[model samples]
Target: MVAITNTTSLTFLKDELDATLSQAESALEVFSEDTSRSGELKVCAEAFHQVRGICQILELPAAALMAEEMELVAEAIGRSVTPERMVGTLGNAIVLLGRYLEYVQLKNAAMPELLVGGINELRRSAGKPLIAESHFFRVDVTRERQPPAAPASTPRTDVTRLCRRMRHMYQVGLLGVLRGESRTSLKLVSRALARIDRLCGDAPMGRLWWVARAAVEALLADEMRLTPARKQLLSQFDRQIKRLVYEGERALESDAPLLLVKESVYLVSLATQDQGLIGEVKRAFSVRPRFTDGALQEELSLMSGAGGSVIRTVATALKEELNDIKSTLDMAAQGAADTDYGDLADTLVRLAGTLVMIGQSREAAQIRGRADQVRQWRNGEVDPEGMDFHALVDDLLMVENAVATLERRFAPADDINREVRNTRISLYQLDEARMTVVGECRAGISLTKRSLTSFIDSQGDRMHLSNVPSVLVGVSGGLMFLELDRARAILEGCRQYIEQSMLTGSGAPVREQMETLADAITSIDYYLESMEEHKPIGDAVLEVAEESLAELGYPVMRAPQPA
Candidate 1:
């Protein structure tokens, strides 16, 4: 494809494209004003269709996609009278496309990626799935990986049967992941991947499994969100597993899908962790994240909106001016002596200039028109008590509402559904103490797991279980202090089980019992991690811990709800 810059023909084409976009904008405005104007909608469709063709000729795929989506939305509007939001989206797309053409002309380059957001918005308004940000991102996935430790297996192991079982395990986890059970499903997926990695050994095919495991770990670590694109990538991993089961070990001989590898590597790069396989993969593949999703969205918001401080200052000044205007209008309507029409017109004229300075040219024009009306009323061209006076007041009220809308547009977003609970305690000190206790509890859980591992290895050694109860008790006390009564109860049950059965039993607990014990401990670990992150602790995890204990013949006590 030819470069977007330094092209005489492209410059001519862009000028023509600009004319078409303006036509689209005009048609869209007509349809928006009167949704019954299907012919205007058809005109918009034709304009965007032409715009799409021009983009394709210029080799601007992203831009073409945007135009194509806009055209489709225009057609949809013609089929039925769409909502105002959809019409507004179409209008914005028309304006944005025009601006993008100007940007390309000025910069002498076409950076199509910047148009992805607008394209997605058009698609969204048409009830279509959004394109991922990485739709334009390309990367080399042929780099050889430093394979993780090979999957443990014997010479007699049936690779096909093992692959089938592992694939089943992966599917179960994928279902959970799809249902939004992120933490638990991620753990299951990681486990399956670890097994698959062992089967693949150090061959080229093993690369996808290990890299995918790292990516899933990153997801588990809250390194990135489980976007639809990422979820689809994980689903592709299952397809690879299916290949191994049907195609036999030969599937492992070939490289994994290039897109899958790139996406997994991309995910690993986004993780903040600099240790273990995730960090190692980053080093080996030389993958460094450009930005996480949240960070990228934040940067986009900053680019699109005026600076916070600038907007706040403008808002304050606008409010003051509007207050004076309102006061004058109110007093004049009541026939007060302080009514001064000339002063009011002058203030409105200045306010119009300020609105234009803030990039509100349409609002500025409206205010300027109102100022002209004020002047006419002052010259006795219209009665102050007539319909004309009432229209002027109504228009001023609309401008006041616009000012309020501007304030809302720049206001910090809040999740009103998750109301922060009020407390009488000093929240700062309480939060600090909670953090300290949560940290210690996390440390204690880690220590207990290690001790439990040693006890299992030592085959009924009492010493390995000695420090377990004490550490758990300490963690339980911290949980109580933090008002996590359920977590405290679960920890207490584990403590009692270790004390009453494991340490005092004649021999090592059976393998099944030890596994169940591990399950209980692991569930508690997951809960604490969620708590530390301030995420909502689901009841399912606690039930899992309770079931594990019950299986071990130690029925857990239901604790009273925390105050």
Candidate 2:
């Protein structure tokens, strides 16, 4: 009678399981080039025999039964392994082993539908040319499988301890490679691999091989190698090892591994006669979600980082440019012909237009139309009767000068702060243009209003007003209103700038300046509106005008109107 101690039997069973898995993988590798059905069947027979031995010793009746079925198929193929019959039998054997391993790990007797479907697919491909024109190989099964039930649970704990020890050893070996101790590390890995092979035998050797390959590649990656063939071989080894790691890692997951195993089985069925499994393997792992139009758009929007700050930055710049254009118009209204300033104004407008074009806004199209009009005026295209040519010319010249100054400030590409400085300069030019526009508009508003009032009084309220008076009034009012709108827009823009600056801890000075300008514009708008509505004529107008002048820090008193 053979006496089997619990500890000894458990150790032997664990070792057998490892040996079986390693042998199974090795058999697959060896048979990968065996085009003959008989050769492939023989390979399967050897693999199943190993699995059956492990299962029977471990007392896993279910696994043993599955192995028996696989053995039968292998035997059948061994008799007269025709391409069609051998492919089907081999594919089925792979699927059965994979499923049995998965079931053992998960302890779920009910096979997964995917597993069943995969088996069916392999069976369907039997006796046909490999569907994917690739061969099949197996990975280590026991390294990823659950331990057999033990009364004391000691064996289970030991298995976990051993796996963890191996993982740590592998990690250290990689560190050795990083430190340029390749030969030492390789020796250490070889010893570790040998120990694992001894402990688990041939079954779990695939895992050891993977760990060894990874260690070798890590060392090779840092080496200065001159041989092309050596480099190519190392590269291939690196890719294969990494792929194996990925698959093995995923297989550790109870459900995920089962799915992969099933897919692999199906692939083997279809491509058993082929010499490579690259295409089939890639297709199996390349599953991705199908995106709808809305989903795609949402994804794109997310990619763009579409948000309030981006919108405001663009809007603020645009508003500033429009204000600059208004400032030029104000100068024109005053009969001022500062063409140098005009060029700067035009350039600012163009830059603003460009920013608007890039920003996400429904109003972008309208701004674009206005930009076209500005462009036409700059190019001597249309002379609309009331269009302010002097202002337009001044704006163009000022814009050009501003752009030239920016061009000078921009450093070469190699400059460390070139991009940052360029953005700053562009922003500074924009700020200057904005302030100039606001200042001119503020000064010209009073003058234009006064001139209009004088003309109205000279003609009297009853004097036949031409259609042009309303048009002029409308244009003047429109310009004033537009300037006010721009100011408000700038105020909103400033808020965004301040928030962003606070978050990023940079650009504080620019943000502060914007906030101050925004506050000043708000005050100006309040005073101006009061004057326009409640006091369009005499003392009331004078009172509000004084308040507005004070707000603007202008000490000059209003000229008394003729009674």
TM-score of each: 0.57, 0.20
TM-score of model 1 relative to the true fold?
A: 0.57
Candidate 2 C-alpha error for residue 180, in Å: 56
Cα-based lDDT for every prediction:
0.73, 0.39
Instruction: Give candidate 1's error at residue 398 in angstroms.
Output: 39
- Give per-residue CA lDDT, model 2, range 97-188, as digits (tens): 55445444443222222223233344343332212211122333223322221122123223333344334333344344343334433333
Which candidate gets the maximum lDDT versus the true structure?
1
Instruction: List clashing residue pairs in candidate 1.
Output: 151-198
Q: What is the lDDT, from 0 to 100, of the residue 436 in candidate 1?
A: 81
For model 2, what is the alpha-carbon lDDT of residue 67? 64
RMSD of each: 14.5, 31.2
